[model samples]
Target: MRTKSPWLLFAAIFGASFLCWKLALEPHARSSGELERAPATAQVDVPPAPRATAPARADATPSAAPTEHALPPSKQRVRVVVRLAADASAVAALGAELLRVDERGREHAVACCNDPLAPAPVGPRELAELLRAQRALPEQREATQRFELAEGGRYAIAWHAWRHVPGTLTWRTARGAGEVFELRSPFTCEERTLELVIAPEQLSLDPALDAPVIDAVTHVTAKDG
Candidate 1:
């Protein structure tokens, strides 16, 4: 171990082959160069996948129809009752006027009785002394009027008087059908309960006239209940 100069046995086999390639091939080539620069495991940007939707169909489209003076079919609630007889001292005071005719003949006065004892006299002997002081006293009376009618058709009631009175007018029908009229003195008559055919909740009327002055109408139907 002392004659070693072949350059110290080639420098002890070149320092035991560089210390066994730095402990086994430089620790597996420095762990494959630290798994190639160890930082390539940071590459994230993944998102893409989603699409689906379809549903809705059932025949749809249709609406509009109603107009022809499209408003007049709602009115029902009628009640009228009137009764009067004459000869109460030759009528010394009395008055009445009520009118309502429709079927296109249009004329609606409604109701009134007494209230003109003056302001309407220009002559004719002061309107025959105001119609002889409105019949010098005496009147048998009964008058009840309530109105509203519009539900479906035909209606009429016309009674007039300036003198000469007698009365009776009735209307009923909810199915009982009973219309009576017996209004005398220039009332003339063709009968038909003064014309009526109403329908939709039913008819109603009552009128009385016993002259001194009278004009009347009765027909009804109303609603709000």
Candidate 2:
């Protein structure tokens, strides 16, 4: 018999070692954590049904309708026309002409044209009396006597005469010694259009002009509705 070859001996030893590992070695070793526990079956939950929303109907009316009483349409514009004298002679002439104008002839005659000494209207009379008393005191007389015209003229007259002048109360221009015309309305009226005609160079400059006389005529306009 030939001696066993070295390779045959090595094969026998390796096969026996593998068989021992499979049976005895594997049974004795402790198991890893993953291998010992069975993999849990994957859990899946079913979702619930969604609720449905209703759509808007065509018959429903909206909440924002407008009311009936809106404001009246605006007027384009409103105005007052105040005219100053165009000519001093014309204004003076108007004062003279007032004596003949018949509308309120009696009132004008005594106060304006005929008698310069006639007493004034009741309210004006009281004022005149007060002024006369002041003038009699001497200190106030100089101031009461002379009134400067805007166009550089002065009238030196008794206090009672100035207080009784008719045109001064009614907003008229006095021409000479007879004429007086109403410049504007003293009542409530609406004029859609107004044309102011001022006389050429009639406006004057004198510091002594009475402010109350000018303001009562020119500044006030009737209030609007």
Task: Find the candidate with the highest lDDT and give its number.
Answer: 1
For model 2, where is the 10-residue window of minimal lDDT?
Answer: 141-150
Stretches > 4 Å off in candidate 2: 1-100, 103-133, 136-178, 182-225
* Tens-digit lDDT string for candidate 1 (17-125): 8888777866445776776663321111112112112111111111122223444234422333322323212221222222444556665544322223212342112
State model 2's lDDT.
Answer: 0.27
Least lDDT summed over 10 consecutive residues: which range in candidate 1? 54-63
Instruction: Write candidate 2's Cα lDDT for 40-129 as tens digits.
Output: 322111111122122111111112222233552222111212233333111211111112134444333223323223345423233334
* Residue 71 C-alpha lDDT in model 1: 47
Provide the lDDT at 25 for model 2.
59
Q: Which candidate wins on TM-score?
A: 1
Inter-residue clash pairs, candidate 1: 76-222, 76-223, 77-222, 88-138, 91-135, 92-135, 92-136, 92-137
Which parts of model 1 are misplaced by more than 4 Å?
A: 1-100, 103-133, 140-153, 156-225
